[model samples]
Target: MRKYIGELGLIITAFIWGSGFVVTSISLDYYSAYQNMAVRFLIGGVILGLVFYKKMKHVQKGTVIKGAILGSILYLAFALQTVGLQFTTPSKNAFLTAVNVVIVPLIGWAIYKKRMDKFEVAGAVLAMLGIGFLSLKFSAELNIGDILSFLCAIVFAFHIIYTAKFVKTENPIHLTVVQLLAAAVMGFIILLFRGEAAVPIVDGAVFSLVYLGIFGTAAAFLLQTVAQKFISETKAAIILSTESFWGMVLSIAVLGEVITLKMAVGAALILLAILISETKPRFLKAMPLREKV
Candidate 1:
């Protein structure tokens, strides 16, 4: 039952993150990417900072600093995504950012000298096929949004690598807070220099920022950090990749975007590949051993 509950939490995390794309798309109508991200992270960071403060038991002075660095990296990652989204369709953006799945394993290999399993290689090929289908519409002229989305993928890959490596070394909650704060601070600096510091007076825009900050960024990141304690990093990444599935679904159902047959087929292949790659028979074999203990 506890295991199921933890898995459910992770599922919810994926759903929330998946839906973030739609919300962000709507928010873009009223706010620039930098402005929206800045506002959201600032509020989210404050909320998380307060919540995690009470749980801080270790006086390890360097913990906050490390988290802040992680937070800064994380901020750049999302900021790039938001800015990139401005020039790309939500579907295209989602698919591109999802490239982090492929990038993660490669990053892991480069940094940790880890070897790629056959399943992972298979997954990468499937993801690349999906990317080809996704980029079909933009074959002639890849827009700024697409370019930014690709860049975002690389940064996000690094963010995942750093999180997996550092989250255990530092206090999870503290690390979460620092990363949030760093993003918020970075967003603020960008907002100021862009001369867009004026608070978005539009009620709808303000509401969007609040939603993204509190729910998408803060609550989501907290859940991810906590959930990772229970699940392997690779599993967590695979599960979160479901965000693309949700994004595509939401785009079709909520936004009334037409779903093409190519998208349907491509998304299915990618999903099937991720499932096959993630569901290891070895892990299932060990279940009985775990239960006996």
Candidate 2:
């Protein structure tokens, strides 16, 4: 029962993360990507830092450095993602960005030598087809932003793998809070380089920043880290893929976006692939232990 509840928490985190696209889109109207990320991570880091400061004493020395490395990867991932939002529609960006589900396994296999079963490969092929359908606009070539979003998927995959490994080694909350701070530190350094450190001060943008900071960045990651304690990393990735589904539903229901048959088919394929990849390995046959992450 407790494990199921933990899984449910991961699903909730995905929902919150999925809805961030629309919220982030709205915020983009008033803030640049660097500015938004800089502010969001800073505020989130501080808020989480306060909540977890007492717990910090419990963290070992090397964990901070490990957290920072993971944080830098995540920072690049989110930065690319937020910047990518500028060139793509919220829904499209949501779908493309969510392709990290497929990317995660590929990265795992490449870097960590984790091998996937046949179903996982099939799922990857299905998701590739889905990406085509989701982003296939006949009228225009894929824009720079769309391309950037796709690249962000790669960065995020590494981030996920690192996070999975690090979570097992460190206190989840400590790592979460410190990583948020590290991302903020990197963003601030970027703002300083861009000479736009003050661009985030507008009163009109505070609410949006707060939402990203409090709900999207801090709350979402906290939930993800804690919930990962109860689930396998691949299973966790599969669960979070639901965020794309929530993004599509919210876009239609709230933004009045039209639902196309291509999208439906593509989404179905991707979801089915995810289901198959996660279930197939465990149920069908046991593989060598070293290949599993």
Candidate 3:
């Protein structure tokens, strides 16, 4: 039941993040990328701190250190992706970012000496292929943006792995609060350095920022931190990769984008990847079944 709850939380997180694609498009019209990062993270951290004041009081130094590490990696990943988008097509950026689904298991195996699960390895590959079909434009020549986006994937993989490690020892609520606050601080510092600290006060921009802060940053990340306690980092990465599918659905429904056959195939592959990762298939088993008397 706990495992199911964790899976459900991650699914919802993916959905919320998927919806963020639309909201982010709207917000970008009014605010610079750096400004959006600063304001949304600030709002998210403040809201979480206010709601979980008791948890805030009990935050330990060790938790703060862990949270800061995760937060820094998170900010770096986003910063890379944001800058990458400036040079590359959005589709290529999205596909490259989703490559984290494959990187997570490799990181675990390489650093922690964890054995790679066959089912998860297959799922990760399928998920990456699905994301490629869903978003990639298949450009032959690589550019700086492609390099940055791939680096973003590596950083995101580290974020997922570290979140799993930290949640095992620290309180999820406290860790989440500190993580958001740390990221918010980093965002503000960068914004100030860039002279892009001004906030947009228009109603549409304000509403979009609040939506991103509350749902995208605060709620989605809180769910991710808590859910990772019950899910392996590889499985968690595969589940979160479904965000691309959800994003396509929202684009079709909200933005009235036409769906193509390619999208249908990509969606099916993503669903199959999740199923394979969740339910370890036994087709490769060598042992024969015995008949009961």
Best by lDDT: 3
Model 3, position 92, has a per-residue lDDT of 93
Q: List the residue pairs that clash in candidate 1.
A: 71-179
Pairs of colliding residues, candidate 3: none
lDDT of 2 by residue, 167-233 (tens): 8878989988888899999998999999988864667667878998998989988888777777555
Q: List the candidate 3 regions with Cα displacement exceeding 4 Å.
A: 284-293
lDDT of 1 by residue, 49-83 (tens): 77766676552667778877778888788877877
**lDDT tens string, model 3, 1-293?**
98899999999999999999989999999999988887888888899999999779988999999999988988999999999999899999999999999999998887888878888888999999998889987879799999999999999999999999999999999888888889999998998899777765988689999999999999999999999999899999999999999999999998899999889889989998999888877873443422221
Backbone-clash count (model 3)? 0
Please, what is the TM-score per model? 0.82, 0.83, 0.96
Q: Which stretches of candidate 2 lie over 4 Å from their true place?
A: 1-6, 83-96, 124-128, 135-147, 200-204, 278-293
Question: lDDT (0-100) at residue 283 of candidate 1?
Answer: 47
